[model samples]
Target: MPSLVDYIIYTFIKIDDSLNKILEEYDRPLRARVFKPKLSDSEVITMELIGELFGIDSTVGIWRYFNKHWT
Candidate 1:
């Protein structure tokens, strides 16, 4: 079985690839000129996926888990 870190990396890559393809086809801007987000959409999605896989049901709990462990 793949390790947790490996799974996270794989998931992020797949999500990013899919998002890029959709963006290319749609040709739409995801953000404005200023106020960039701290994390990319793919990163956020990957984090949430990881949280769900590990049974983190609350948004606050997911944030706390990643903040404490990922950082």
Candidate 2:
């Protein structure tokens, strides 16, 4: 069985790979807005997916869990 950390890492890898493939298919560069985000889109998606998979409902709950435990 995979541990929590394993799941998180796998999710991130899959998301990042998918995003890269998508960008390549469209021939578009990843452009940031006026302000860059602290985390990448893949990271954010991984966090959200993990949170939902584990039944974490609130954004703050997800952030706190990852911040305290994963970080």
Candidate 3:
């Protein structure tokens, strides 16, 4: 069996793929400004999901957790 981390990663990948597909089918502008962001929408969403899964309440806590584990 795959480890818990592996399962989490797999689920995240599936969710991201689905999100991308939906976005592609839409006509709405994804970004608010002309300038592009460093991180993709899917990446930001994955981080948000991680924050929720880990019970992080604040944006700062989410950043800290992501930086600690991802960076």
Which of 1 and 2 is ahead in TM-score? 1
Off by over 4 Å in 2: 27-31
- Candidate 1, superposed: residue stretches over 4 Å from native: none
Off by over 4 Å in 3: none
| Residue-pair clash count for candidate 2 | 0
lDDT of 1 by residue, 4-53 (tens): 89989999999999988888866567665578889998999899989999
Colliding residue pairs in candidate 3: none
Listed per candidate, the RMSD to the true structure in angstroms reads 1.4, 1.9, 2.0
Pairs of residues clashing in candidate 2:
none
Is candidate 1 or 3 superior in lDDT? 1
Ranking by TM-score: 1, 2, 3
Candidate 3 lDDT score at position 5: 72
Looking at model 1, residue 44 earns an lDDT score of 90
| Model 3 whole-model lDDT (C-alpha atoms) | 0.81
Q: Estimate each model's TM-score.
A: 0.88, 0.80, 0.75
TM-score of 2: 0.80
